[model samples]
Target chain A: MIELVLSFLKLGAVSYGGGWTIVGLIRTEVLRQGWLDEGAFRDLVAIAQVTPGPVALNAATLVGHKVGGLAGSALATLSVVTVPILASLALGALISRLGPRGNRFREALRSGTFGLLAMTVWAFAPEAARDPFAAGLALGAFGLAAFTKANPVLLILGAGALKLLASFVLA
Target chain B: MQASKPPSPLRLFLFFARISAVTLGGGYVLVPVIARGLERKGWMEEKDFFSLFGAAQSLPGPIGLNAALFAGRALAGLPGLFASALGVLVPPFAAILLVSEAIGVVAAQKQARAFLDGAFAVVPGLVAALLWRMIRTRAWNPGRVVLALAAAAAMILAPGWAPAFFFAAAALGWFVETPGTKA
Candidate 1:
């Protein structure tokens, strides 16, 4: 149980992005740690998304169970979640006084945001490249978004549906 | 690192809780809201704000939670981290708890029925749009264009083939776009 929690803590401790990057990180850790194989890990990712809870929580629980059953699941979950929750509260307190106009702080925030954007690009790169359709769909979707002020949700649904239609119609 | 005198723990807690409850959408969506909230109050300069955001992206955990931690640590050091963490978590925890308790009661409701049906209907479209946006802003490789299409084919043809299709797409992007380098 302790090991399970600690491993999850390790994941939280080292990751560079949110749910997105965590996917890659989790893949590396789970495979390296011998917690699960590629097949099982893939399945878990799907289930994690479909499940109602947060993706991280589902992942932690699954990893924990593989490592040490119910107890492991509980520990991993707590460890993964604890640090960030605390940090956000402290931030809230800080912000109440600083305001956005503070120049230095604002610069830091902008740089940080830029860095995040870059990282997100890094994170999504691999997924975007492997499949031609996904690539085109994403590009078209992006073009639509960039060019028009359309609702994002509509774009996503349309892409999925359009692809399905294309597959059958073209086939 | 110099630790500032601890701020009131309660103040820290309430502040984050309010942010969490009011924030719609995900972490990215919360960025502008948080920035405005802090900027208006004068607690952090824009540079510091961006820096924290960058750091948050690089950190493990949810972006929202990461923001809380960065803000807390900036405000009051170690103790602040603790306060913010609890505050951010309380809302989701309370919400989940409430939903779990009421799950049985709402299991047969008409509103619930409509919500489930309506929400699912739009999910694929939303995914498509988000996937598009993600590609446009982040995955702008010509090679990625090819992979995404292939993956989509694999997914539709072989139901439940594997999410590896997606990750594989990402990994392939790094290779195809930049030879001998993995993203």
Candidate 2:
């Protein structure tokens, strides 16, 4: 239990990017520590996404529970999440002080963020764009969201139906 | 250093907790929510919101996680950090626990399965829509577009390359801009 909490604490403390980044952090930590094999870690990510709640939270809970039961879940979650919270706050405060200097450090951070964001999306694009019909649905959904303020959920349902129809027609 | 008094920690926590609890969509969506919330409270201004959005997205984790931590830390020091983090998390955590307990009731039924089939099917599109919004944001530029394309190509070509590619890109950006390198 102690180890589980400690692991999550470290994972949470350092895993700064987001849910996706947390996966990598967890992979490194867990695999290095022999906590879970790669296959199991992958399975955990899948299960975490489909199950509900925050993916990161779910990941932490599963890891903790597996190693230390309910108590482990609590500690793991706290460690993983709280660390980032403090870290973000600290970073934000630091950025505030730099205060509109247009310094290279700040500019670089901004540009890097844009690049990272774009790259992150780019990484997912192909698979996400794989189904032509799904792609159209995504565009239409984006349009609805951008223009009509339609509930995103509705567009999603519409897209799934489109996919189902495609399976029959295209197949 | 301009010494302005920081806001109360408890109030900041409550403010963020409300934001987290009410947010329907996940992390990215919280960007707008926090922006609006912070603006209304006078905790941060518009420029601050945009910069924070960029920094938060760039840094790596969930936007809400970063936002909560940033907002909390801004309002107070360590105590503010704890409050903000806890505030954003507790509501969602509690809600999930309740839902997860009830999730079993719907897990096996035919009707439930049918409902979930539809729900799961829509997920891919939902994911795409979310990605599109993030992609089309103002931060996007030609260099980013190329990086994105390459990243996508790499991910598709080798499904296992996500972490390496992402970190490598970040490292590239970091090192390329390192102060000494620029000079």
Candidate 3:
């Protein structure tokens, strides 16, 4: 439990850029610590995405729940947000002082965040490659989400429904 | 309907709670909804909210959550800050707990596994799309492109050591982008 909370705390501290950026970090940490199997973790990320919050925060809470139960969930949620709240409270005034360099700082952070996203995409590539139907859905999802304004929730549910239908047909 | 006075902490709590509960699609989608809602209530103008949101983006955590904290504090001080924090957090916590509990039951069913497998499959594609957008949006200099690719390669190689690589990228970007700042 303590280790679980500790990991979230550390991840929360470096979780600059946004939720997506920190997601890859969470994946690496959880996988490295042997907390969840790959398939389970992948499912968890899917759940986290469709849920109504930050993906990273949802992932943290769910991972905590799985790893340490209800008490773990509460503590992990608190732990993940602790640093950001503290930083927000403490450095609320610092951004203004950053001047033009602030843009540079943000751009710099972007360079790192891009890598984080790349790692995430890389890590999950195998899941997309698991089957032909899965690959098609993945490509379809990328096309719609990347090129159009289709809601991701719809995409997720649509894929699930299609897969379920296929399961029934194939069975 | 203009709010003549800043919202009380409890009011702020309810306000944020309501938004967090109904808003979906994570930070990018949530932030705009919040800004519009605040505007609609006359609690904060979109301009003021977005400027504060700009500050919020500079911090870590989800932009939606951070924006709430900043807006709450700006409107109603320390009490509002904590209240807003709770508001943003509590709904999702409840929602996820319910879903996880439900999932644990259905997970044993064959259909459920297939659906979940399909749902999970889109993740890589979704993330890849996100990366594509990031790549398109950035004002990428050649040097920055090289740096980002190098950093990506390193992080992919050593996922466990991602934090170090991230910091190294940030520091290098900071230094290399502006030679005039320190000198």
Candidate 4:
């Protein structure tokens, strides 16, 4: 339990950019530590996405539960959030103190986020490419999301429904 | 109609909880959804909200959760912060717990597995769309674009050095100013 909390704490502290980047980081650490196998990790990722909240947090909760039940879930969730919450508080204070100059710092961070997100998308590409049907769905979803103002929740549901239909046909 | 009195901590908590519960695409997409809700409620002005948002982006953690913390702090102080954080976090915790418990049964069904695969596959596209939107909306420059592409390439070529990539990007960003902005 302590190890689980400590591992997630490290992840929460170091993870930047976005959830996908965090997911990548979590995947690496979990796999390295023999916490979860590749297949289990993929399922966790999928479950994290379909459910609400940050992928990292969901992953932590799920992984923690798997490892140590309810107590682990609480510990993991708390550990994952502690640094972020503290950082947010500190940053919030600093921003107010810095005033307009803070905008520059914020912009820099935003740039970093963009870069990280781009890397994350790149990392995810191979997994996405593994299945042709999934790839097609991904592209179509991208088009829909990019061009239209469709709700992502609706799009996710639609994707699930489409997949179910596809499975029936294939079966 | 704006309430003459500030919202109670419970109200703040519930509001954030609702937002977190319904939000699908994760933290990046939470901004607009939050802004819209806060605006509708007259809880925050546009300028204040964006500034908070900018700060949230600059901070660590999930942007959505960070935003909630900031907003909650702004709205009602420490109590509000606790309330909002709990509100935003609870639903996801419950949902993930429920799903994890049921995954044993769910994974066994081939159709369910396919459905999940299909849904998970679109995640990359959704992220791509987000990237495209970010580029389109932000003031872009040659240097920033190059850095982004380089970062992507680095991740592809050397997955092991992923952590270094983030640090390097931030370092690059610190030096690279936004286009048309004076140093």
DockQ of 1: 0.09
Runs off by more than 4 Å, candidate 3: B1-3, B179-183
Model 3, B1-183: lDDT tens per residue? 556678899988898888888776678778888899888878899999998888788787877789899999888899999999999999999998888787777777898888888887887888788889878877777778988998899989999888888889988888767743321
lDDT of 1 by residue, B5-110 (tens): 4456567777777776655333544555667766655666666777777656533467766776777677767677778766766654444334434544653555
Q: What C-alpha lDDT, on a 0 to 100 scale, does residue B30 get in candidate 1? A: 50
Q: Candidate order by TM-score, highest to lowest?
A: 3, 4, 2, 1
Give the chain B TM-score for each candidate. 0.68, 0.74, 0.88, 0.82
Lowest lDDT sum, 10 consecutive residues, model 2 chain A, at A107-116
Per-residue lDDT tens digits for candidate 2, residues A12-33, read 6434335644444465566666
Candidate maximizing TM-score: 3
lDDT of 2 by residue, B1-183 (tens): 233456688887788778767664456556677788777777777677676565554343566777666656656777887787777777666655554445547545544433334333333344444445645553544654565566546644553444455545555545444343320
Model 4 residue B122 distance off true place after TM-score fit, in angstroms: 0.6
Clashes by residue pair, model 3? none
Summing lDDT over every window of 10 consecutive residues in candidate 1 chain A, give the lowest-scoring window.
A106-115
TM-score of 3: 0.93
Q: Which DockQ values do the candidates obtain, in the order shown?
A: 0.09, 0.21, 0.63, 0.56
Q: iRMS of candidate 4, one decimal?
A: 2.8
